[model samples]
Target: MDINMKKILLLGMGLSSVFLLSACSWIQPLPGAFNVALLEEKDVTGCTKLGTTTSSVLSHVGLYDRDTAAIKKDLILLAKNEAVNMRGDTIVAISPLQDGRMEFAIYDCVK
Candidate 1:
């Protein structure tokens, strides 16, 4: 490869890395989101169902795949934030992560 071509390729790779890393930080826990509890269906007994929430984030940056753990973590945070919006204090995953999306059941189980 020519020197110019090499420089361009390296720059592209560096930019892609930056974009992927920055994307991870784009999802933040909203107020009260951290207080929301993640529980299993068995533990949500007697809790009032407040509907469900689905969260989706970037699963890939261009051709490179993002970290699965980071994607799952962001998905959880997004779900918790949605749960808080529905006046729910707890959440239970209703579906596994797929296509960077996951479903969660929100419940008001504070009582």
Candidate 2:
């Protein structure tokens, strides 16, 4: 009923809306574009091994927990980007690290 109480309620609603919207995927940073192939160690026989690449995803505070699928997707994209930078066509021996990171050996294949 009071003006002060109404203002406080409005401010609280505004803050709550901000927090809720911030948790949406649309508000998050866009995922990078890198479409490198994921291959096994034996599959890189004829491919020239470039080097190893590592990537990670950090957890953030949100109304809902971070999506593991999204995290893995981003990690894969990060690794592929690294492979692309290395002039590789595929990433071999891909492995997940204990620290929520991914490691892969980059390779350039002549197919």
Output candidate 2 Cα RMSD.
Answer: 5.1
List, residue by residue over 1-111, the lDDT tens digit for candidate 2: 999999999989987776664444432322332457887898788988889987876534344344566557666677777777777878864676434477879888856
Question: 1-111, model 1: which lDDT tens digit per residue?
Answer: 999999999999998776668456577788999999999999999999999988999888776677888888899999999998888999999999999999999999977
Off by over 4 Å in 2: 1-34, 62-65
| Candidate that scores best on TM-score | 1
Best by lDDT: 1
Write down the TM-score of every candidate: 0.83, 0.62
